[model samples]
Target chain A: MEKKDTFIKAIQENERLIFKVASFYTDSKDDRDDLVQDIIYNLWKSFDTFQQRSSFSTWMYRVAMNVAILHLKQRKRKVPAVPIDLGALNFAETGFDGNEEKLQVLRKLMNDLNLFDKGILMLYLEDKSHTEIAEIIGISKSNVGTKLSRIKQKLRQQVNNQNQKTAWN
Target chain B: MELDELKSNWENSNNRPANQNSLTAKMIDQMIQTKYDAKLNKIRYPEIGGGLVCAIAIVFIACNFNQLDTAVTRSTGAIAILLLILLPILSFLSLSKLNFESAVSESHVQVLQQFAIDRLRFQRYQKMNVTLCYLLMVAIIILLPKFFYGKDLVINKAFWTFAFSFGYIFLLVFSRLMSRYYGRSLNQAEELIREIKETTANS
Candidate 1:
């Protein structure tokens, strides 16, 4: 019971990160809820194995991304719905209320990247250091740096194209 | 739109307070317990259901074993009994390989790499299952008449025409639908693996 309490506290603390990852992976609300539930469940299951060499959030993000890649890309097997009040818990709303347009554009660009690069981009956007990003993603720090630069370049070109088109209009 | 600009915007916008509906201990317990019960989970229900059905089927087939007078019935009865015995074992074995208990403990690269191999193996098993199902469908159809009314439909010429035309087409369409569904996921995984491999090599 105490362990469960600890786990719940940890989850509530980092729930935003979980929702952020879930929203990045899924488009529809149903899929988002399912993914969030999955991330939470996986985190709970792997909770015992967490040795805490890193921050809890960092470890949690690793687990979240790992599950998301193997999960969201795999065939979605619908599990029985739990009776949790998912409707009441607007976790993935992200508090990005005023920047809907910017959020949409960021999401559009993020969606275009593959899962691997998206993970990198997500970590980058979260302002994760190259070292921490490398640690979480299991790449060398140099690789994290290299991937981020390439992703940035891709985003730059995309933004420039969008801007040019807008200017022409 | 640039990474830095978006990063700053995201950081700023994400600063709004967390939702008021923070989960209570009771809610957390329920959520976790729901999955805990599911540790044996969705397939377990079907497995139990299937095992009982198979048991009943095998019992019915055995009880009437002496009455299977025709060659097709006898041969297909044997096949159906074999199927009843083997299908459950096959399902249990295939599903047993899909454990995700240790997934979150592994690194992202390791997880994806293992997932690629596991997905291929799972795809192969699915293909085998579809083929086995085709055979099971045939065997069950051949034997249903015997089970219900002691008639040997295999001996009837019309039975073959009707069963093959309709049965094969039904199975074909169902299998095609399943294949297309899984094929999309397979393509996604394959593409992901390719891109990850390229990134790994370049890095």
Candidate 2:
């Protein structure tokens, strides 16, 4: 197959996964779009070195996740606060279908986590195996489990606190 | 929501449009080109700034070349002329080595580590450039009078001595201040590297 044909096919097959990864790393639609473009750019650059050691989807996960994390770090260095239009987020479809409220609250919860925990939570939410998450994130499997458990606990506490505030209000 | 419930929502969320129309191959190629262009332009800006300063110094020296008479004045003029040629050439050579193309195949940790190293290298080069220019200015100021007015120097030896002393003190203090500023950036890069290592390490 031609390179462009294969590249487009791969991206078409994995756009949703890539979109989720980019959205997890960036809060604003503009930033998310930039991150996605960067991920695609990096993927195309590294495609020749894919070597097919793992499944193509797995390779996509590795490349997309790494690009997202690097983008996040560079943005953090450039601007401490990511300028996000809360309303603009409402326009972009997160692929969550009818669960817009859930997605919003989840994004809020994610904002409370540090960069490392955010990666763990993103991978965990994808239902990836601990070993797979570890490989993608370059951390130990046990560390992934430990961090995921802690992240879940943190999310539960935040939800509970929100519920308390609603009841009081 | 609970963890299990969130997983179900996430898995169900994969029903995005299955077309690859958003970012085309042409767009990707453009992004790659823009990325390198931006990198090269970064190095070019500094080179241009250094070149301008060099040009101005050469013009100033050329207009004042007739003042050299004694051996002391002649040697000072020669040193000034040498620096007028040397500074920009050295800056361009060092900056040429720093046009490193970032590889997309590298891992996140590898990329971050390389970024920290490259940034530190660039910052150090900037610090050195600033210091060298300041010292060169001081040297010229101290020597220029001896070339242009050697007779006045004998009558006002104390005044020239005082000016040189003040200039050296200013150079020392200003260079320290500049180093501190650059040092903070280097420290920030080092801290970032440490954070990446800690997060990625198996332990």
Candidate 3:
């Protein structure tokens, strides 16, 4: 009973971390849900070996990343012909206007970035610092700084390009 | 707008669903069940390969008892074959029991680390298979002299010699084929990892 409670508490506390990581890896709600489930499953399996050497969140992030990566690999192998529909998810419920055009542009830009950069930027947006990001990503602190700087510049360019095209129209 | 404001606005504007608490609980339950099943299965049954190899060694030794007149030589042959068969099976079982899930919960970084370890294990298995084939060939070679000396041995000397040579060639071909198969699988796994890395780095 104590173990179950602790496990449930851990899940409740880290739920956002799982969801955010899943969202970065997958665009659709269904995929995000699957990724989150996989991460949770992985975490449960690893529960006994948790030595308390590192923070729980850091460990959870690693598990989430792994599950997401494996899911992508399996998807590639299976090669489903139909694409998932993200249209039904109300951006408005999340507070974004239900503007198809803007949403389409945002989705495209998100897809343009690589998985690692996406993860970094997602953590950044969640307000994780260079040191924390570096710890999560298994990179040097300086590398994180450089990568974050470059990522921001790339994002700015993409947004500017989109804005210019919109204005021209 | 400032960069921080823009990021905050983007984050605020993208209202995703509230994290599903119930689903997370269910997933944990599923994981526990799976782990329990795996453990029970391991405890209850002998490994398929280990059992098969033991049976084969017993049959081989039983058939060749008359030829191996000396008890010491016969016992040594049986023990050698058993060890050769057992080594790969034990190694495989140990590798199979590795806890990938625990590593994941420990840290996100350990995911890739685990995968790299898995690839190494596959390589080791390939080497073990090749070694086992060689050991079998050596056993056959040792037994060849007894067959050659027996006038009533079913096969002719020419046929025996040809078969021995062909067996060595067959081992080489088999090793090459198995290596290629494992190499392709490893390459595919690596490619998938690389793709994930690239996607994460860029996104």
Q: Which candidate leads the pack in TM-score?
A: 1
Fraction of true inter-chain Cα contacts (below 8 Å) kept per model? Answer: 0.54, 0.25, 0.33
Ranking by lDDT: 1, 2, 3
lDDT of 2 by residue, A1-169 (tens): 4986798778867777877788777767667766766677678777888888677877788788777756754563222222222233233556577768877787788777655566667778888899888767667778777778877898899999999999999
Q: Highest DockQ among the candidates is held by which one?
A: 1
Select the stronger candidate by TM-score from 1 and 2.
Answer: 1
Model 3 residue runs over 4 Å out of place are A1-6, A9-38, A41-57, A66-129, A145-169, B1-49, B59-64, B68-90, B93-111, B134-155, B183-203
TM-score of 1: 0.75
DockQ for candidate 2, C-alpha atoms: 0.23
- Clashing pairs for model 1 are none
Please report how far candidate 2 places residue B170 from its true position, in Å: 5.9
Per-residue CA lDDT of model 3 for A1-169, tens digit only, reads 7877687679767776766677777766666655655666567766666666668887677667767766664443222212322233221232355555544555566677655566677677778777877777776677777777877787788888877998999
Fraction of the native A-B contacts that model 2 recovers: 0.25
Model 2 CAPRI quality: incorrect
Q: Which stretches of candidate 1 lie over 4 Å from their true place?
A: A1-15, A26-52, A67-114, A146-169, B1-43, B97-99, B201-203
Per-residue C-alpha lDDT of model 1 across residues A3-38, encoded as one tens digit per residue: 987899898788778777876777776776666777
Winner on DockQ between 1 and 3 is 1
Q: Model 1: per-residue lDDT, tens digit, B1-203?
A: 66788888777766322574366667667777786676556666676788889899899889988878888788888988887888777766655544576777777877776676666666766777677777877988887777779788888999999988998789879888988878976776787788678767876
Q: Candidates' lDDT values, in order? A: 0.77, 0.67, 0.61
How big is the positional error of residue A47 in model 2, measured in Å on the Cα after superposition? 1.5
Query: In model 2, which regions exceed 4 Å deviation?
Result: A16-38, A64-129, A143-169, B1-21, B24-45, B52-66, B69-102, B140-180, B195-203
